[model samples]
Target: MNTMTLWHITPAEFAVLAFAALLVGFSKTAVSGANTVSLAIFAAVLPARESTGVLLPILIVGDVLAVLTYRRHAHWPTLWRLFPAVGAGVVLGTVFLLWADDEIVRTSIGAILLLMAAVTVWRRRTAEKEEDPDEVTTRAGRAKARSYGVLGGFTTMVANAGGPVMSMYLLSAGFRKLGFLGTSAFFFLIVNVSKVPFSAGLGLIDGPSLLLDAALAVFVVPGALLGKWAVNRINQRLFEQLVIAATVVGGVQLLVR
Candidate 1:
């Protein structure tokens, strides 16, 4: 295990950390995985290496709540189908992180977000009536699924920012509200769970991180409640739009910094 010094975080910094954790909890459960923004905020406010370590445990707590809330709605077939490809991408990402610089990672994430955003716009403009299941399953769906799976896995493993990638895919797939939440919840449960060992191996999980996590757990409750309210009050179209907007902003921030 790598030895790390525990920086003496001030009360103000601890408050910032708690606020970020709150956003993460809300994003995880209510906003369809925009917690990447919270991750970025945490990273910006702390050491990048330590940020990843500190945030993982907080995320797990949020994830448990999300799974509990959305378990019945998951599309297991989609989750299972994406796993092999996503796992491959995760392996590739972990290897890349072993040597890559922060700028490179940030730039890659920005490019991906732009690509996904462009695809989403193009589909919105040109897509005809939704293709029937038979049409979907034949050629286009499989190819799209494979592409999204690979992208999601790589982006998530590297930066915890796969929310936008998967959001675009799920949006284009034309899932209803419940299905979207369910699919996302299940997908991330697996992806995040898989990341634990790799994170540990990469020295992103350690004692100080656990201490930070413990401090932030208290904020998750209010975030979850707020998320519940947001999900119920926001119409589907607006909700999705907000998610896209948040993702775009977060992606741009990552790229710029």
Candidate 2:
């Protein structure tokens, strides 16, 4: 059998799929920004149009794990405050997904990522003199929070590509280790749950997708375990630097491709 009967996936492609899923699990539980690489890997390994569909269910599974692990640490008030704007953004993204071209949508997502990364880097550098990297207090915190919320909702809805966007926002907000992890867990739990309806509506999480997700999910466990161990070993400064660098690279790849 050619294996096309099994979701059109081959043994060679299966390895790539596993790697991508492992990254998703790892990023979800650990880095939060590394999922972009997973996304890129999926899109590259599968047809771009079908890739998102296949990845959605796997992401939902990972989201469940992340929420469970970090449930106690979330900042619920912040989550509520961001919900309305995020909801609006999701609606907008659904509308776009319904009517937009695939390449256009992907390219736009890339550009947005690039722009967001640039802004994040600029803010960090310009604030170096007066800013305490660990201090969460800042004049622009609220405004930044709101902007990040809207952007996060939009990008995630459009591409499942909002991790870095929110990561930067939270980092800028000075959320330390547990808070950062918890806030992210809650944020994604809500966001991913919300996307289920959207993904179903878009036919991105049907039978084939679910099967693919199941096969790929096996890799997530190890990745998440690895991430949990890795996080404790890395400090805040190093973490932020890695995140920024990852975002920049992800953005560039999306744009350049």
Q: How does model 1 score by TM-score? A: 0.93
Candidate 2 lDDT by residue in tens digits, 172-252? 666777778888888887788878888787876667667777778888888877877888898888888878777877777
Best by TM-score: 1
Runs in model 2 with CA error above 4 Å? 1-6, 128-140
Model 1 over residues 28-103: C-alpha lDDT tens digits?
6678647767877787877765576677777777777778887898877777767888888888889988998777
Clash count (model 1, backbone only)? 0
User: How much is the lDDT of residue 198 in candidate 1?
Assistant: 93
Instruction: Kindly report which residue stretches of model 1 are placed more than 4 angstroms away from their true locations once superposed.
Output: 1-6, 131-136
